[model samples]
Target: MTRILQLTDLHVFSTPGATLKGIPTRECLEDVVGYIQANEHPFDHVVITGDHTHDEQRASYEAVRSILTPWHECLWQVPGNHDDRLLLRQVFPCRSEDGPGGTVNFVFPAGHWLCIGLDTHWPGEVAGVVEDQQLNWLQEILQQASQEDVALFMHHPPVSVGSVWMDAIGLNNRERLEEIIRADPRIRLVCCGHVHHEFQFRLHQADIVATPSTGIQFSPAGTSPQFADESPGYRVIELNEHAFTTRVHRLPVIKYHPAPDA
Candidate 1:
């Protein structure tokens, strides 16, 4: 079985003072990294689904690179709404000179599985778009993929998760994307993030799962205030041939006094 980890919406910031839970967002991400390092699991590959930085700040993006480089020994990433493409390119080790926009999507073989990472970021917007190029590439990849061994990772979940605000920011071209996946029997699972709460669904006959943020979380059932008191977390996905499993772990932290709604 090939295990892949997904960490998302980190929102690493430079001057994270009183705005972010009285703690630096970087610290929260460090906690997640520590948990992954301490909790022994030889993940075949790591996927940081997006929002690696907050406010699109250069320093915040650099902080993300600092936190993620050690893990880059086995990792691939896609961008998010809060990301700046130019800065992210500078941060990631695999600096691509592919095209003018620097698309970071590709297919890779990992032992017993075939995985594809798709870049879903749309500049200055919360919603995502796959565009024609990504879709064409995806179809070609899946067409050539071994049956029952393909998986996909993206920054935005394709299905709506009942969060009105979040739904408004999901994949904008989901129908077209769904058409591609639905036609391909080789696809085993679809993994994503951006919505800061854990969400799951069956779309295009594939399992779609989104991990909560490593830095913070949005109340699973809410509409305002941005984040909730939920623990920071990440997903460990076990991939075996045709089967895939995800286990979510919450980080350990001491909050100030009583947690709201505790």
Candidate 2:
């Protein structure tokens, strides 16, 4: 079995002492990283689903680089609404058969899995979109990998997570995305971040898995923005030849945060 470690929504700020939604975001992220380092799981790859920086500052990105430096060669990153695409590309450069652009989309091999990273971020917008260029590029990869199963990683969830506000800011062109996904029988899993809460939905023979934020988790269910009193978490996925299994690993002690002032 091949194991992949996924950590998302770090929201690391320009300063190490920053906080997000009342949780010490930097410290929380550190805890998650420490856990992975101490654990016995040997990950084939470390996939970060975006929101690497809360402020999108150079310093913030630098902080992120420092945190993941240990696994630099095995790291894969996608940009979130809050991230700077250029900065992300600078910090985590990977070989892509697809030609250059501000958009970062690429495909690579991870053990027996064909891993694909899609960039859905739109500058200055909370929502995301899979543009025509990216769509076309992905279709080509799908055709080429028709004989093998692929796992997609993106910053935004293509499906709604039952949060009215978050859904409003979800991938704007998911219908097109869904069409592409439906066309490819090789797609087995779609892992995403952005909602900062865990969710799963199966579509087009693929499992859409959303991981919780490593810093602040959003309310499990809500229309408006609300922070949840939950521990930071990550996902551990084990992929075998014919099947794959995954589970969310949250901190043992739940961290409490008072509801933001209305």
Candidate 3:
């Protein structure tokens, strides 16, 4: 079996002590990283969907690079609504360079699966869109994939996740995206970030999934925007012949403690 790890919505900041929703984003990421570092099972690749930085600052991305560089050999990423795509490209040059007009779209190999990362990031907007250029590119790759199982990773869910607020900010061109997915039998899974909550469902022949954020999680069942009282989390996926399995792992909430008048 081929193992892959999915980490999303890190929201790292340049300031080491910076917090989001009352929790230090950096520390939360560190906790998740620490757990992965201690795991016995090795991963073939690490796919981070998006929102790597909350402030979208150079320093914030730098901090992200520092934390992830150790596993750089297997790291693959794409931009989220919160990310600066140009800066992202500069910092993480490992993405597919042959995409249409510098769009962050590419197909790579992960075990027996053909992994695809799509850039749904719409500049200066919280919502996402898979542009026409990206759709053309994806179609080209799908044609080449043949019968190989393809795993798609992006920052926005292509389908609604039962939350009205999240659905509003979801992929704007989902109909087009879904059309492509329906046309391609090789596309087996669609995984994303941005929801800050774990979600999974089936879309025709594909399994759609979302991982919880490593920064702050949002309430899963809310019709409006609200933060969830939960800890940071990530996902582990095992790809086997003709099938796949996954599980979401969350770090236990760490209560803050003050140093006594030191």
Candidate 4:
């Protein structure tokens, strides 16, 4: 079996002890990483969906790299709205296939699965975009990997998760992306970040799921953005030749809580 760990929304700041919405992001990330190292088995692939740094600075990226050193060799990443693509590439050069300044997308094969990471980052915008270029690229990849089951990783969800604020800032061109997914039966799972909460939405043959952040947790209920008083978490995905399984694992305790009106 091939095991993959999906970690997202690190939001580490350049300043070591900085916090976002009252949560010390770097500390939370360190705790999450430590917990994984202490409790889980080695993962075949460590996929980070995005939002690596809230400040998007070189120092912040480097700090994130240091915390995630254990899985660096098996790491795969894509950019999020809060990320600086160039800085991220500079820190983790091998994580993306793109050049100095290109969309950070990637693809690899694992057992009977074809794992693909899509770049949904839209610079200077909170919302994400799935351009025709990416769609065409995905089409070509799917054609080539026709025989294998597909698992997609991206920063933004292509479907709404019922949060008015989050849905408004979701993938802008989801219709076209959905069209492509509907045409491909091989696409079995689509794991996403950006929502900063756990959610599952079925899109035809694919299970489009959103995972919790490794730092801060978001509430899915409010019309506006709201923080959840919950522990940071990660997703574990186990894949074999014919089947796959996944679950969300969170820290046993909520080390820090968000301010009620932050």
Clashes of each: 0, 0, 0, 0
The local distance difference test score of model 4 is 0.91
Q: What is residue 179's positional error in candidate 2, in angstroms?
A: 1.2
Per-residue lDDT over 1-262 for candidate 2, one digit per residue giving the tens place of the 0 to 100 score? 7788899999999887767766778788878888778874678788888899999998888888888877888787778899987777666666322333567766767656788989888889989988887887888777777346789999999898878888989998789899888887778999999988899999979999999999988875567888888899999988787678999999877754534662
C-alpha displacement of 9 in model 3, angstroms? 0.2
The lDDT, on a scale of 0 to 1, for candidate 1 is 0.76
lDDT of 1 by residue, 1-262 (tens): 7778888888888664423554456778877787788875677788888888877888787777777766777777778888877777777748322422466665678766788888888877889988877787777777676655778888888788888778877788878888887887677688898888788888756888888887667765556535576678899888876677887777766442213433
For lDDT, the strongest prediction is: 4
Question: Which pairs of residues have clashing backbones in candidate 2?
Answer: none
TM-score of each model, in listed order? 0.89, 0.93, 0.93, 0.97
Provide the global lDDT of candidate 3 against the true structure. Answer: 0.84
Per-residue lDDT over 85-166 for candidate 4, one digit per residue giving the tens place of the 0 to 100 score: 8898899998778822378999989989999999999899999998888888888888888456999999999998899899
Candidate 1: residue 223 Cα off by (Å): 3.9
Q: Clashes in model 3: which pairs?
A: none
Mark the regions of model 1 whose C-alpha exceeds 4 Å error after superposition: 16-23, 95-101, 253-262
RMSD of each: 2.9, 1.9, 3.5, 1.4
CA lDDT of 237 in candidate 4? 97
Angstrom error of the Cα, residue 40, model 4: value is 0.6
Ranking by lDDT: 4, 3, 2, 1
Model 3 ranges with Cα > 4 A deviation:
96-98, 254-262
**Once all C-alphas are superposed, what RMSD does model 2 give against the true structure?**
1.9
